[model samples]
Target: MSIQNFLSNLDPRLQRMVLKNEQLEEEGLHTEAQKENLIPVIAKVTNIGKFQKITGVQKVTEITTAPDRSGQIVTAHIAANALPTVNKSPVVIQLQGAQPVKPLLKDTAREINLPSPQESSGNGGEGVIVGIVDHGCDFTYSSFRNTDGSTRLLALGIQEMMNDRTTSFQVYNSQQINKALGKPDPYKELQYPVDKYTHGTHVTDIAAGNGRNNKASGVATKADIIFVEPAYWDIPRGNLGNFGDSINFIEAVKFIFDQAGNRPCVVNISLGTNGGPHDGTTLVEQAFDGFVTDKPGRAIVIAASNSYADNIHTSGVVAQNGHIDLHWSIPTNDFTLNEVEIWYEGSDTFQIEVIDPQETTVCRVGLGELYHDGQIFASQEKSALNGDNVAMILCDVDREDMSTGKWTIRIHGSNVNNGKFHAWIERDNHTIGIQSIFAASRDNNYTIGSVSCGHKSIVVGSYDAKNLNTPISYFSSAGPTRDGRHKPEISAPGHGVLAAASLTGNGVTGMSGTSMAAPTVAGVVALILSEAKALGVNLDIDQIRTILERTARHNPPSQQGWDSRYGHGRVDAHAAVAAVRAMAEGRQPLPSAVTQEEKEALVRR
Candidate 1:
């Protein structure tokens, strides 16, 4: 694949950025200030030949080449003047930085009735791998060690931010990890810090960590683990910049899959973004879907996100020639600029007008137009908001305009007959003190997020183990995705679930959210794969999903079939393992194939 093909296929924001960098380079804008604005991107190619071609054209650096010759990973400093020429060549996939996906976590493992290590010893997930792509991990944690006190970690990949304004990837195998653990400072010995954020260790413990002192045992207790910590850069004002981007995530996934070799593997991703179209059309989503499709013994599980109760999403239908009004609540004391993205069917055209809380028209911009008013500027563009064909509104709020009231946005439909539009209030890990509300009759669905909305991935929602009567967590993101696909295929114990704490002496800790719920399912998948591998069978993703749904325990208020809130219901690991065993014995039929219509529908967005 050629770099030009990859650049052309990138998300529009990234495509535009790369093209702008090429333009600047052509104009001799090579000064430090000019180069500072250039976008850094990672490109994954099919082979070393394509990697060489890309590096020859751009200032590219190799991240890693797959040991199996499956692909090559490289990063490039895309300048404004060095855009590659497009030619007839193979299409190469590329991705850029997306909104950060955060950690969701823990509890009473007893709530889900996790089997004892002795009980599951016959199929103790020995031949399977549990891959965790998250923050840093605590390799020295007892939970990650074997009964002999040897490390159970198979490999580790650390994505580091270099001082040269580029990113570097360092991978360590079992020997290296064990050597580092033998040192006085294991993290320093490995030249990487411990799980300081603590998110990765907690998540990893929930999925495959062995019990420490007979406490906090995770699913797939015997499964080997592989982990990655994506690159992160801390910026000013308490914001984390350049962390959890799509590029690093893709690379991490590739690394895990390649290293798993012939072993059955399941990867758990508790991170997600609410930025892209709820339909999985982004390059990252497409790449993942392709990787998992038709590939038996491989799976990827993701968090359904914690956006359901955030009051940040508003959706409504626009009648032909009629208008709808949305109220955006801006906090009074915050002076930071905010952004809100509105998405509608590409075929439909609409107009948006913003009125200040003081009842003054501040600005109104239609599709592809930029509205500027000194410090307060607004803009709308087509296919520029996170690579989706939607209208985006960027608002730079002056401190004087932060009146802490409902700012009115009136949207008039031009050709909309039955088309619907969704507006999302952008959220960061830190508090920005802004909220959004729709008319009482409007706001209904809140079950959507980047990657979670993907068609093939298993998106897990959160439930409360402590309260069986109210098992569904209030924060769990529920979904009939934007494309009307029932998301969050299942729910799991996430609230107050106890797991290993990082950097502590055989410590146990508890956290809550869908992040915790996802790894639970990943661990169960490991168990299933382990059993299937023993039975000389390779389970497809669809088969694993069907087994889970069939064996899950339905919570109250949700029927036996799929429900938006609980998917097929709370995950039942014991029953799920039993079901896989039944399938192996030819007592049950395999899952039905995905219809061609269904396959096409996944990418329709």
Candidate 2:
């Protein structure tokens, strides 16, 4: 089917947006000079089976089945002439430019006093698979090898970007990866290289590394591993593109599920983005929730994000017919472009106006306006700005334009019932000359990033284990999601964690962040899964969460119950394992010593 035929079949509202996107592409709205990045649009088609039967359109690229069999997910290039056809589909979900999730990077797993592989009754995740979906991994690292020196990595899926701007997606069994490693350029033959970025290697080591050289062993030393490295292309002047999109994440998860077969798997995502609605409404978040649901022995762990100290989030409420001004301080010497997004309730409507430092009106967009000319934004960017019921402002401040200094955004309420909104500055790690600062605000709710905010995923916060009081890490993100759901459901030791280093074969290094903390939880979950498997019981996501929360070790003053800062509290692997054992034996688990009311009082104080 041609793009037009596919688009013609979509709902009228979707057809308008998709058509507008096509028009923008034809008009060269995304020219090189504009610096507007284009991303794939993921469509969830409920009647995919029906649509495929009538197929004459181009084959959908990067196709994956929705876990629940609800539909199919396919990626569409922004510049493609033909859009995929979904005739009379009940629902279609679209998202643009999910920012690349940066590594929240590490820790001493032993600090939490995890049980040793030999001491753990279930053979330390002997039958479970620990899937690390990050950058590439160092499959040659001895920590990933068996006693016979064979690789424990069951499979590897590599998503690479070719020079022609096409994707090179392939999956290889352990035998293929091992055979390729013997060649001069293993990556060329195997299609996936050893830990080029290093983050994946360290994370995998912490979760399932075998203790070599008498070093500290990971939580699930015997668990198999499945690694994914999504292909990414670097922009001419900026960092890599296509790194953080939801498509890659979903594809990675699908690959792991295929490889694991019947074995229980615990997937860890140490990377995250603060770009989307922190409420679990995005298509990617929903897909993740669907993937884990009803799939017993399957779970995903995500970092709570490292934006707590970044000061990029500002929140406020506007009264009826009232307006609020937000100041964003841009450093004087910075020259790179920046992005700002404002999210509000779906029922509320607001007008957004951006003013540069010199009081020039850069642009103004109303609630229902169509800013499709793309003079300053990509098609999806324009769609997100005008259609997603949010205000997305991109500031391209060059040194010559005097765009630096205090820029102001005025948000005027047009219709207000629930007038609250959360504004965030896009992460600028790769943009060398840009920095964003938002004026402090009173209502900074929903600071957690995407994927981590997923309702089904276990989001982990970080704490300093070296400190006697175990204070929450200053950089650990806090959250009661926009819709008011408690997040970072648990905290763990993330400060000064030592684990295997990717660059040196037998070397170890120390790193910190919620990234490191999440894998700690993932490793523990692996152990739990192993124990549960032995007991002949399959534990789902909710059961695992409850066991972890009940068995967690909290500080004296605030013992039981959930807190935004420390969910149920610091994770205790040994206690969690014991509790799982008790439950498996048909005996009641031990009760908490502290009462729920006391915990609430501590939170209030």
Candidate 3:
């Protein structure tokens, strides 16, 4: 492959790193760049050995191999100088965006036939394992402890800082957690004071908290818990997409399953980024699909996303030999970087040009090319695996020279066989730092996050569980994937959900997001898995989706079946378990899809 072609295959971050390498060498900063540059990536390949050998890899770990044995997902680090070798040999399968690492839930458990810990054991999810991969976890929370004050977390993997330009993890088993709990200062002795952000702990509580001190209980309270603090956001205050990431979640999932060792395990990943094809075909989504389908009694649930009103998506049909101007605005005083990804048919090509807020063309990326000015960057590439094209506009607001305001993106159709194209603003947390968005012709559809698009993933959206209407959360993302496949198989309680607060000594806290909803479904899945295991019936991802689709309670009460706001509907934990029991007894058969009448008829009370 030519150097340019090889460069196009690398992710946007690594591509920039490669181009920057030569400049740094010229300035005698090669060593400094090496010290600060550790590029960790997840790639799918047919031959792992060849991929490692060609990439000059010092270490390689296998995350997952697809169920149909299509490819293997592996993590390999590339030095700044090794960029040229990235996809030249043993090609690295690409996802959608160039997400850099930055530092970056829950429900009632009683709906699933749980009385009280004293009255009943709540064995509905007993003998199952629940896995959590999120920003951080608080093992010291009483909700995560047994009645005797012993830790309920089976294993906790905390991502350590990058050392020698490589990511590492420090794992603690129940024994180690117990040892730390016995210390005079557990937080000081354990060396992890991540209570400031209780994201992981809250989500975990919604999945497996034991209802300590009469707090809000989770569905799978009796299930063992495995928590993973993702490496990218393990530090202090990082945006969701600014820090280099992923592959850590895959590593964490693999670790949890390894520890599970044939025990029915369900993983709840309450975090995701809006940077992928959203077609269940990206390498990351492929790996997630593999995780659940590769074995029976295994499942994964992810947030549908919370960007419904973010105005991050826009779509239009570019006329042949004509152009469409897409307006994008960068909020003022924004210090962080922002980007937009455009995807269309691979057969058609478009001329990409970006006009700044000042109405001056900053950069024009040609067909099958990459362009980079000091403040702006652009690129277009055709996927060799999936026959889809992806183009991107990235603005570096952190640069002093970069301007912030309304910018116009001009996409001129060249070969207009299929002019329909969709563009998305990559995930930005938009805390105090201003976030950029599409200013005009914005779209709300196809807002589901990256990995949640997987076919086998039971994606969960957020809803107002406390409201009488049980309304869909205003922030819950809408989706019918890029390929027109229904996503977020179900919705769940997320608005003002009462769950655990980290390091608060059994105190309860209320938070809301799709992150809270995912664990609700995961906890319910654990109940199904536990019952399945006891009945000597193993359930695969297909069966799980079917059971969920058939059991969810419709949101609008008369909306019939699936809608973008709520897939099948809000999750019904009790209905799902009953269906699982019926399936185990051979008294009920799983239906493939909602029938026409099912979509037309109002959901009767």
Candidate 4:
């Protein structure tokens, strides 16, 4: 897999844990099925998604069989012998020969032929599809419009209201988007409340905005667009709602890729969670790896989360025949749930207990047991990676006088050998600001969040786009995953990236985060896809990763190749695209013969 080739090569991403909370009925979370299950579960799916830690594979049923232009995608469900199998895939990529050159990409208008496809005359991501899976997808923005005032969006998928949770995919094709653009209130016509979410619009614009608003255009201006708005994405832990799972994120990516058809597609994910075994084997991460490996001409880019300084991670070891207590601080004002996952070598059997801030043992679970009350839930399960075990505790208060501040989790080593463990507090996505944290033993390292840590994801870190003095954004997470795999393949301008304000006609705003950087890479990858399509070449995940890493520019100049912060260095779109053209032409893909002026020119852009 190309992920192994990433930063001395190794892999990592998480399953969306369904917490029994009322907010599950919102935008990306509802499915009706989840609404009724009122308890936080690491749910197992019998079909149609990815699964992890299934001890045996009793059955393998191919859900859908079709030959993708790149390769065929065979999604299957694997569950433990007693439990219904999870919809996970042991992804098999049977690479086919070069696909015949397809037509010019949708709405591209013209075909380009240049010796160096990255030249200004080369198409700006034409002949490629850019998929965006995030919230607040506003297709009405001018940046998404063609020169003729028509939409450049290929399609948009929304997880509709709760009643419609069981309904089929609610899709808006290009015609529907165009119709919405003509109405008095485009959102009313489209049924997407874009005003609530500007994140998607900003990310999409950065990846493929056409620059119609006199603002800076995105990297792949002419690339076609596909978007999916997961229901639970917009509001994070609002109304004392339960914590939402990222399974919707996986579904969102699947929908985008499904909608993309055979076209070369690059999807951007500016969303992630701070919890998961950093070893890249969580069910959802498995899904990500499966999807990316399903075929060539497919790739996913994720923001390498901003939890670097959040104190969301901690690590320690329990002495054999001894015990340890982990302190987790629940903020005084936070009304949402707090979840912490402790991962350790499975060879050691540990009994766990969760104590509230009042110093009372609220719930206890021994080896192979799961304890759940409305307020506290604890469990110990076989880990999906490295034959390890995961101890998880989640708190959902029941009374008005809820416990606040440091909660202690006690881990007693019953059978000890390899008693070391790692833990992470869940991420906060909304603006309420308050979040739980580890009170002690916090480690900023290994902070790249799940899905971004997936083996197939092109994880991106943030550079201070607006502050050259700081180069890297303070919040951009540092990594070499828990398993010691280099992460954050590259860095890009994220801070202060200005783009269209959600649902505001002609309005723009500036936002900062690693979320802003990932889309930048997605757009650049689109250019690479476009070039590959033009040259009639087939590119798998590994090949694309190689090109990007090979062409990255050294950030600090003296820093040697491949560090945890920036896998290669900062991404160079022009160099990446040029390398693609060079590969197709059988020349030096990343030629080192460029003149001083050309290097400066690339730097200037």
The RMSD of every model to the true structure, in order and in angstroms, is: 7.4, 6.1, 4.0, 9.5
Q: What is the alpha-carbon lDDT of model 3 when measured against the actual structure?
A: 0.74
How do the predictions measure up, each by TM-score? 0.82, 0.84, 0.91, 0.79
Which stretches of model 4 miss by more than 4 angstroms? 1-122, 164-167, 233-244, 384-386, 399-402, 429-431, 589-605
lDDT of 1: 0.67
- TM value for model 3: 0.91
Supply every candidate's count of residue pairs whose N, Cα or C atoms clash at under 3 angstroms.
25, 11, 8, 13
1 or 3, greater by TM-score: 3
RMSD (CA, Å), candidate 4 to true, equals: 9.5
By TM-score, highest first, what's the ranking?
Answer: 3, 2, 1, 4
Residues 1-605, model 2: lDDT tens digits: 11122332222223344544466566656545322333345556554454344333223444554545655556543333233333333343442333555577123565566765444567888889999887758777778877766778888777765433335567778898678757877666765545543888878888888776257777788799998876532222222223334566676776787678778999998887777667775666766777677478888898888888777888889999999999988776665556677878767878777777789866666654423232222111123212335666655555545667888888888889889888888676544525577855634446677667767888898888777788888888888786788797888878777777875767777878888888888989999999899888789888888777776766722755777867778887776776667777787555644344443332232
* Residue 509 in candidate 2, Cα distance off native in Å: 1.4
Off by over 4 Å in 1: 1-36, 41-77, 80-97, 105-108, 115-122, 163-165, 195-197, 233-244, 333-337, 371-388, 396-405, 431-444, 590-605
Off by over 4 Å in 3: 1-6, 29-38, 90-122, 234-243, 399-402, 429-433, 555-557, 590-605
| Model 3 C-alpha lDDT per residue in residues 462-514, reported as the tens digit of each score | 88867677788999999889999888788888888888887777788888898
lDDT of 1 by residue, 413-511 (tens): 877745688877666443643444332444436555777776678989887887758568888887887777888888888877777778884787778
